[model samples]
Target: MSEPALTKRGRPGYDQRAILEVAVAAFNEFGYDATSMGVLATRLGLSKSAIYHHFSSKEELLEQALDEALDGLEGVLLEQSAQVGPVIDRLAAVLRGAVEVLTSRLPYVTLLLRVRGNTDVERAALARRRAFDRSVSALVVEARDEGSLRGDIDPRIVTRLLFGMVNSIVEWYRPEGPEDAGQLASDVLAVALDGLRVSTRSTGLDRLDHR
Candidate 1:
């Protein structure tokens, strides 16, 4: 038999998962709306028809990629460590789990972060993300109530700031870098739970009495 045909990119045998990886990368690099089926096909070195053989449309690809990120995050809440520990420990588990998810699924998480709710796929992803945030906020509140975390700041603000630090990793983190996910998670927890200073003496926030 003749040699198998190659795509324009000189590859053969594209599968759904491979197609999604490329699509998510393109979506993260260029906005989702701007990254179309044509763009994916071009990048994959395959024809649009070959792509459609795996997915009905670009929206399906987006939905699948978002699910990859959201499912991993939601699963973190279900872990035994996250479920049955002291609320402070549980919150730490969730935060560490979130970091693990982000680092392991960097491309998918990056795409999830960039979604703006412009399409139904994006809106659904946002809804799921908000639900995950709410769960983390609840953990924060419980930790404060148990006196493990400080009670001064609003739990909502604490949750936002905490995840803000976690999520910002998407901007500059590289899988090939020196720090592994576990180390990075430890660093995040140290900063969040302990603090930048050696001692815990209060200064600016205490003086402001913003509460």
Candidate 2:
């Protein structure tokens, strides 16, 4: 078997998905500061101009990848919130779908997590992330109103804790790991909503208003 050589220009040998996969891997291994279009092109077996044709800049690629993850979450929330169910049940379904996204689109979501307002693109991504968090927090508030979740903790604070734990899965999850994504989501929900014991929490918004 012979090794493949980098082809010169005109349409590039790789497709958008191929480029993104290589780019994301580079970003993951090298961090955003260290990765460059030249380096990414070299890694992907394409020329610089070829890569540029697909992406205006390295930051554009980063932004697009972040958008992919954000868009997935936005879609999940939009669809799940419309469904009829007990508030906690809806939450569990939302989380299960979120886990599916986190697993299926791990690279994109992983890149989303790594953004830290270092540049204009990163700042935009951070803003989008906050928007998503706010939306999720709204759901938590709704869940609280429905009396499906504990009311002692502030809803906004609890929302952050819930998402912090959900988002933490990217740190330890393996695509080929023994546990499936749905199972992981369920396990997470179990710990967050249920706990170690099997106490059946009921639904209704009977919480005394602290506001």
Candidate 3:
């Protein structure tokens, strides 16, 4: 397959990254299987050859777009915040980072979340996502072992519950919406790490007596 090469001028500043971002949005709007190269070219206001200059095929575009999504999520694990803290703190940092990545790259992450793994690219992306989950679950195990997280809950289940809440943001979150990424991240950590109900363990069940 021919790699993306810049030759003829397409839309202004229509480089590979730009094209891939637009393609991600398109794929999110119209499912990847339904989006044709011609439709993608139309979305970019460019000819088919122009898109071909960037991506060899629709599948190639899908691969790159999914890569963008996976890269954003995976990069968070390597951040200093995720690595240097106590296990629960590290988990909080990872969750916050994941939320920021999801909201900032809404279209790409949305496309990533929707993949059903029918294609090789989808399968690869799914693999990377599961690997990320395992890494985070490791933190949960550490936190549980050290008595930070609740010992009654399985570490793997805790990891899934926390991540499930984070991942669900892609369903309704919008970059242009009222809540920004950081605020949403804070709220997620607050509710996930802390109970939604009044802390009966801390204040006693008498706090519930008022309700």
Candidate lDDT scores, in order, read: 0.89, 0.80, 0.86
TM-score, predicted candidate 3 vs. hidden true structure: 0.88
Residues 2-68, candidate 3: write the lDDT tens digits: 2444544542547788888788877888788889999988987789998898799999999988888
What TM-score, over all chains together, does every model reach? 0.88, 0.84, 0.88
Residue pairs with backbone atoms closer than 3 Å in model 2 (clashes):
146-204
- Candidate 2 lDDT, 154-181, residue by residue in tens: 9888877887888888898889889788
lDDT of 1 by residue, 1-211 (tens): 1234555677766667777888888888888888888888888777899999889988999899999999999999999999997999999999999999999999999999988899888899999999999999999999998999999999999999999999999999999998788999999999999878865455434645556
Best by lDDT: 1
Cα RMSD of all models vs. native, in order, equals 7.1, 8.3, 4.5
